[model samples]
Target chain A: MALAKRIIPCLDVDQGRVVKGVNFVGIRDAGDPVEIARRYNDAGADEITFLDITASHEQRDTTYRTVEQIASEVFIPLTVGGGVRAVSDIRTLLNAGADKVSINTAAIFNPELVKEAAERFGSQCIVVAMDVKDLGDGSGRYELFTHGGRKETGLEAVAWARKMAEFGAGEILLTSMDRDGTKDGYDLGITRAISDAVDIPVIASGGVGTLDHLVDGFSEGAADAVLAASIFHFGTYTVGEAKDHLARAGIHVRR
Target chain B: MSKTVAVIDYGMGNLHSVESALRKAGADRVVVTDMPDAILSADRVVFPGVGAIRDCISEFKRLGCDETLRAVIEAGTPVLGICVGMQSLMTRSEENGGVACLDWLQGPVTRFPQDHRDTAGAKLKVPHMGWNRVRQISAHPMWNGIDDNAYFYFVHSFFVPADQCDSVVATFEYGLEGASAVAQGNVFATQFHPEKSHDNGVKLLSNFLDWDGSC
Candidate 1:
C-alpha cells in the first residue's frame, strides 16, 4: 500500500490579495485567496498551497494573516510557503491551519533549517522548495535558483534535493524557472531528475498550459503531485477538468 | 422535489464541494446530513471527505450509520463514498500511526505501490496527479453512460487494495497498477473526484443513477 496522488492548486498571495504572473512579472490580480481557495475546494482540489512570493524580501507585512482567512474557510488541507524562514514561522503557519510549509531560499542559505523544521514539526510538515533553471550551456544540467527565482546559486539542483531528503524533508516542490508562466508544459527533465533523486513527494510547478502538460508532469516527470498557475488563475482549465483528464490518462486521482 | 441525495457529512470531508458538484451534475436535491434515516431515505447516498482516517471511522460509529449503511446496501440502495469515504469501504485503514476501518472488504488501506518501476521500468510517482485514462473491466452499474478508457480526476495519498481482484471494477496504470474503481455488489467507490472530473464525473454519477441491476 502507498499514498495516493494529489492534485493541488497554488495561490500566490502578495500583500493581502491573490495574484499570478509569468517569470514573476506583469502580475495580475487573480482574486482574493479565500475566494480562490473556495472555488478550488468546490472544484475538487485535493489540497491548496499558498506561495507568498514577496515574503522573502518585502517588509510591508507583519504576519501571514491572509492564509489564516483562507485556511479557516476551506475544508481541504493546505500548505503555506514563501519567506518561511524560521521555526516560529512554521509554527505560526501550522497554528494558522497550514498542513505544511515550503522552504526555498532559506533552505539554500542554511541547509540545516530543513532538518530543524522536520525535527520540530515532524518531517511531513516541511517541504523543501527548489527552483531550478538550465545554465543553457547545452549540457542540460540544472542549477538551483532562490528568492522567488530571482537569484541563481551554483548548487546543482538534484544534489540539493537529495540533501533535503536526507535531512528529512518530507516533500519537494520543484519549480522550473524557465517554464514559469510559459504554459508550454512542465520541465519534465528537471521534474524527472529530482523525483528520481528523492524518495518523498515531488510537486511539479510552472509551465502548465493545458491538461496534457499536467499529464506529462505526473507520468514523464514522475512527480508525486503537479502544481500549476495561469490556467487555474485565468480559468483556462478548472481543477475538475484537469483531474478528469488525468483519470482518463490512467493516473490515480481523488474522484 | 429537491432529489434529496443525503450526503453523510461526517467531520472528515469536503462535503460542500461534493454537494455543489452534485448540483452542477444535475442533482436537484443535495443535503449534508448524518441522521441515519435521512441517509436511508435519500434516493442516493454520497459520503464526502478529506481528513484524519481515525476521526472519520469514529464519527461514523458515533452517528451509528455503520449498520444503517449495511441495511441500505442490503436493501439494494445506491451509495457512493469519495476519497476517504471510498477508502472506508475497504476492510480497514492504517493511518495516524495505525487505525482500523469498517472491514467492509478485508484489508488495511495502504499507500500506492512503487512496484510499477520494478516490474516494467514504469515511472513511479506518489500522490499520482493529473488527467489519466481509466480502463473499465467488469460491467458495473457506475459505468452506465461511460465507455472504456475514459478519463477522470484524482488527488490523494492513500488507496484501497481489494481482497479480491474481482473487487476491482476499473484500473489505471501508473508505476504499478492502481485500482481506480472498486465494486462489491451495490457498494461502489472510485479513487478520483467525479465532482472535479467534469463530464466524466457526471457520466459516472448518471450511470449510478440509471442502474437497473441487469448487468
Candidate 2:
C-alpha cells in the first residue's frame, strides 16, 4: 500500500489558549489547545502541528505544559513550533513530548542551526517552516518572510526550501502569507514548486477553506500533507469529515 | 506479580512517549532505564532509539547495553526494537559513514536511494515520514488482533534488507520492498513507531506485552 496523504490540524496557540486568525491577523480564541488537540486525535487526525503564536519567553513554559498535556492524551505524532530558537529549545520541546519541532525565524538567521539540529536529533525530527509571500512583481517568485510574516527576507522561497532540505530538514512546513487566513485556498503555484524542489515532505499550510481546497493542495500542489486551523477550529468540518472527503476524492488518507 | 517491561534508555529516542504508550497498552510497570540489571531482569525489554546510528551505537556500547542486551536475548526474553533500535540490530549500517551494529539480525541497514521514485515516476521523499501499510508475511502472537496490511507511523531514511526472508514477519513497499517488521524466536523489531501509530500501534504494543516469547 502507498503512503497515505496526511491531513494535519494546526493549533495556533497564543499565551495558553488556541487561537485562529486570517491572513495572519485578527486573532480570535478557539478553545484550549490541549482539549482541541484531543478532539482531533479522537477524530483520526493524521498528525497535529501546535504553533505557539505568541512564542514569548513567558509563554514558553505554558507551551511546554500544553504540549505535555496533549502528548499524554493524543496518541498521534505532534509537532510543536513558534518559539523554537536554538538547539536547547528543540531539546526542551522534544523532552516535553513533541515528536518534531518546526524552526522558522531562527532557521533564516542561521541556516546552520538546521544542519546542527538535524545532525544532533535525526532529520526526521527537524522541520524547517517557511513563511512565504508572493513578490507580486509577476516574476512568479515567492520571498521568505519572518517575525510571523511581518518582515520580508528577500530570499527566494524555493531556493531556501532546497537549502533547508540539503541541510537535512526532513519536512518543510510552507505557509503562504498571501493565502493565509484568506480562506481562498493554498498558493498552489509556490506550494508545488517547493514540494518539487525538495526531496522531503512538504506540508501545505495557510489557506484551506474547504475540503476541495485540501484535495487541491494534494492533487495540484503535490503536497504530502495539508494543514488548516480555522477550518478545523471553528467547526466548519471535523477531521473525520475532511478525511472522508479526501478519501472519496481519490486522495488516500488514514481513516 | 505484574510483568516488568524495561524500555532500554541509552539516552536516545522518544522514551517518554513510548513508555506512556506501553502503559496505556496495559503494561503495569514500565521502567525507562539504562541500568543493565533492570533490563536483564525485566520480563520484556523494548530497545527504542532515534538519531544517528553512529551515536546510537556509541552510546549503546558506552553504557555496556550491548552486552546486557545480548545476554537478555540469549536468555530468550521477548525483545522488541523500534526504529533505530531495529536498525542497530542489523550487522552494520551505512549511516554516519558506515557504522557496525549489534549483528543480532543478518542484514545491513542502508539509506533509501535519494532519487527514489514511485511507480507514477513521482519523486518519493526521504525519511518516508507518516503512515504506511504493513503486509503481514508471517503470523506471530504480535499480529494477534491486528489486521493484515494495517497502517503504522514511520519516520526513517534507513531500512534493513533481510538476508533471510523467513526471518521477516512483515514487509512494506516504498519504491522497493523492505522489511517493515522482522521476527526470529524471541526477538521482534519494526521500522515503524507503533507508539505513535494511534489505535493500531496500541494494539501491537499490547500484543507484545502479552507475547510469551514462543515462536
Candidate 3:
C-alpha cells in the first residue's frame, strides 16, 4: 500500500547551479545543486525536484551531466523539469539517469507531447506543471504561464489540467503566479479545484510560508504533495519537523 | 562477542556509505567481504551495490558469494539487500536486456512507471531518484521503533512489481504500487537506501540491530 501524500523541495537551477527567487526575480545562489541535494538527501526530504528554468529558454538542453552528477552523489529519486520539449529531450535526461521528467510550457503548446511521452515513457514518468495565475474575478478564470512563468497563455487552468491527465500526465504541478514569492500560503482554491477535478496526483507549488502550509496543501487542498522555497531556504521548517507536525495534524505524511 | 553484521562486498556495490552508516548507527561489528564462512558465521548478512541486475547476478556468480548467502539465509541468519542489491533479491529484472536474480523475492524487477497507464517505460522516467516517503504496513520487526510513513532515500528506475502482497512490508506511490520494502522471515529488502537517509536511516538500521522479530 503506497502512501498518498508527500512533501517535496524544489531547487530552481540556472547555468548548472542552484538558484532561488521571489516571483521568479532576484535569483540568488542557493549553492551547488549537488551539495544542496546531498543536504536534503541527508535530511530525509521525501523527493528532490530540479527545474532548469534557464535551459530551454536559453536554447540549452537538460543538465544531463549535472543530473548524473547529482544522481551519483545522492541515493534518492531525482525529478528534472524545464526545456523538455520533445521525446528525445526526455530521453537525454532519463538516459543520464533522472528518475522523472517534468514538462510545463511544452505541454501547453503541444499537448500531444504529454500524450506521446506518457504513451512511450509511461504516464508515471510524465509530469505536466502549470504555472497558473488567478484572474481575480468571480468568473474564477485562470491563465497558464510558461517559460519559467514569463509567458502567459489564455487557457482555463482546470480544463487544461483535465486535458493533460487525459493525455496521460501521471502528475500535475500547480504553482500560483500571484502567490509565488509572497510566502503567504498556497493558492488553496486553485489547488483544491484542480485536485477535485483530476484523479492523478497533484503537487501544490508556490507561496509556502510555514509548516502549516505543507499540512494545508495536503489536507485542505487535498494535494498529494507540496513544494516551497523561503521556508526551507531561510531555515524556517525542516522536513523532519514538518512531517512531525503533519502527523500530529492527522495528515498522512512520511516521518 | 559483540553481535556482528556482515555487509558482503564483492566489488559490485556502492557500500562505502552503507558501511559507514551502519557503523555510525552503533552496529558493533560491520564487515565488508566475500569470505563465506565469515558471512555465514555473522548474526546478520547484507548485500549492497548499484548497476544492472544482470551484471549484479554475474558478479555474484563470479565470486560464488551467491551460494554462501543462500546457505546462510536458509540456515536462518537474517539477510538484507540494498538497491541493485535489493533488486537482485527478486526472481528477474528487465535491465540492459534483463537478468535472472537471487529468487529471494518473487516476480520481475523494473522501473516504477508514474501512472498505471504506462509500464514498458516509453514515456515515463526509468531511474526514479530522490526521497519519497514509505507507507508502512504490518507488524514486522522492521517497524520496531520506527514511526509509520517515515521518509526514506530511494534511487532506482526499476522496481519489483507487487504480486505477493503479504511479502511487501511497505509500498510507495510514484504513480503506482512500488514494492518499497519487502520482508519474508529472515530475508529483508527495501527500495530506499537507509544508509543515505541520515538520522532516519540510522534509526532504521538500529531497529534492525535490536529487532527480536516478535512483533
Cα lDDT tens digits, model 2, B1-215, are 48899999998756878988998899989999999889999999999999999999999999999999999999999999999999899888999999999888878888899788988888888889999999898889999989998899999999976444457889888888888998888999999999899999999999999898997
Using DockQ as the measure, the top candidate is: 2
Which candidate model has the greater DockQ, 1 or 2? Answer: 2
Instruction: Sort the predicted structures by lDDT, highest score first.
Output: 2, 3, 1
Candidate 3 share of real interface contacts: 0.10
* Global lDDT of each candidate: 0.73, 0.89, 0.74
Q: What TM-score does candidate 2 reach?
A: 0.96
Question: Per-prediction DockQ, in order?
Answer: 0.06, 0.72, 0.11
Q: First chain TM-score in every candidate?
A: 0.91, 0.94, 0.91
**Candidate achieving the largest TM-score:** 2
Better by TM-score, candidate 3 or 2 = 2
**DockQ, candidate no. 3:** 0.11
Ranking by TM-score: 2, 1, 3
Per-residue accuracy of model 3 over A1-255 as CA lDDT, tens digit each: 224356788888886777763221222434677777777767767778888867444444436667877766665556898888898888777666566789988888899899888766556567899999988787888889875567779898999989998887878889998889888889999999998787677889999888888888977887877886667666777777888888899886655
lDDT of 2 by residue, A1-255 (tens): 379999898888887787653221222323677767777788788999998887468658888888888888788999999968899999999989999999999999999999999999999999999999998998988999987688999899999999999999999999999999889999999999998988999999988899999999999999999998888777788888999999899998877
Error of 1 at A117 (Å): 12
Regions more than 4 Å wrong, model 1: A1-128, A132-171, A176-192, A205-255, B94-99, B106-108, B114-118, B161-165, B209-215
Q: Give the RMSD in angstroms, all C-alphas superposed, for model 2.
A: 2.9
> What TM-score fits each model?
0.63, 0.96, 0.62
Expressed as tens digits, the lDDT of each residue in B26-55 for candidate 3 is 779888789988898987788876655666
Give the higher-lDDT candidate: 1 or 3: 3
